[model samples]
Target: MIVIVDYGLGNLGSIKNMLRKIGYSSMVSSNPDEISKASKLILPGVGAFDTGMRHLTDSGLLDILGYKALAEKIPVLGICLGAQLMTRSSEEGCLSGLGWFEAETLKFQFDGIAGKWPLPNIGWRDVFDVNGSPLLSGFNSTPRFYFVHSYFLKPLEQDIVSMNVSYGFEYACGLSKGNLHCVQFHPEKSHKFGMQLLRNFSELT
Candidate 1:
């Protein structure tokens, strides 16, 4: 069964509801045993980077999840803050990340594009599946996904980027490499497009 890591952050209910809609069974748990046995895993978070990392560490899930996703090579998907945590570190916090990806989470700087957009990029935005990954299967047309974040991931390896979205400037919003996959947008709130992505992930070996 697919397991949703519950380390005291994220909209666990919404993720579980979305999976149920796609006819997939998922359980939300912080139990290391359950997490270790998961056929697939979803790491969902909605909070500060340091806080999320601390919760995972305090709950003893940091090591367990690291082992399952990295060592065991289990297919894992991280949403939003969870996605950021997959990187090496974040400007939002000093604590190190899970380091699953050679990337870093950075706060969006208005810089030259000031007044063009607002911080914490909220609402629907278009995302282009540059690589046409299996995780983004069935997106025949330009798909829009809901995003609400002040920070975005900067992956050192551009090849791992599966999708890109334009805010003040273009940024990597989706990443896939081996057993690791992540999305900065909320697929659970992206309607039909999001549903299809979730279904696609469920079908992955």
Candidate 2:
């Protein structure tokens, strides 16, 4: 079974509904027992970086989550703030992240020509699957996903980047490294594209 990690944040119901719509069953839980039994894990979150990490720490699922993702190497997906938590740190907060990747989350600083763009880039934007990851499988045309954030990821290793997006300038929007994967957009709110992406994730071994 797939377990959506409920760390006091995220669109849990929306994610569960999307998964169900795609014919995949999932449970929302913060229980370690339920999480340990999961074949795959989806770490979903929103809100401030420090707060998200604090909630996860307070939930006492961090150790098991780390074990599952790092030791057991289960298929783990992180979304939005969850994705940021995977990095080493973030400019938005002083707290250390999950450190799944050698990356950092940075706030969008518009200047010069880029200054025309607004903060908290909130809308559907085009995404380029540069690496053609299986997570993005079956996308015939250019795929777009719903994004609502003021921060973006800057991975040290570019090869791990699966998708890139441009608001004022290009930045990594999706990442894939072995059994770990993450996306900056909200697939649950993305309609057909979201459904297809979630379906693809379900098919991952």
Candidate 3:
């Protein structure tokens, strides 16, 4: 079963509904034991990164995830702000992240560009594969996925980036380091491509 982390941060209902529609068994809970038992763990988030960490820390899930990720080596997938939280830190606020992936969340400097691409990059856009992650199996190099975020995680190694998308500039749209994987786009919100992506995640060992 897949466990969707619910820390009062993201759209828990939408995510649960999508999973059920796909005929996948999943549970949304803050209980550490239940979360640890999840065959695949999905960290989905919305809103601010710092607030999300506050909720995770408040619910005592930070330590649980940290231990499970490094020790057990369970497959953990993070989406959007959830993905950003997997990094060591962010420029948004004070709270440190779960630090599952060796990366950092940073605001776009729009290198040489006159203006920023736009905050909260919402809507459907193409994402191309970089690291050839199993989560993107059968999808072409550039497949569309729903996106809605401001900041993006910059992983240390090129292999950590699974997909790349262009806004004002190209940034790491998908990332996977070890058992920790993350996507800047919203697979649940994405249309046909989104559904298949979720299915691929369930197939991960």
Clashes of each: 0, 0, 0
Which candidate's lDDT is highest?
Answer: 2
Ranking by TM-score: 2, 1, 3
Residue-wise lDDT of candidate 1 within 1-205, one digit each (tens)? Answer: 9999999999899999999998999999999999988999999999999999999889988888988898898899999999999999999999999999999999998787766777789999988886767787787788889999999999999989988999988999999999899999999999998999999999999
Better of 1 and 2 by lDDT: 2
What RMSD, rounded to one decimal, does every model reach? 1.0, 0.9, 1.6
Q: Which stretches of candidate 1 lie over 4 Å from their true place?
A: none
Better of 2 and 3 by TM-score: 2
Candidate 3, 84: how far from true, in Å? 0.6
Scanning candidate 2 in windows of ten residues, the lowest lDDT window is 109-118
Candidate 2: give its CA RMSD in angstroms: 0.9
Better of 1 and 2 by TM-score: 2
Q: List the residue pairs that clash in candidate 3.
A: none
Global lDDT of model 2:
0.93
What residue runs in model 3 are displaced by over 4 Å at the alpha carbon? 114-116
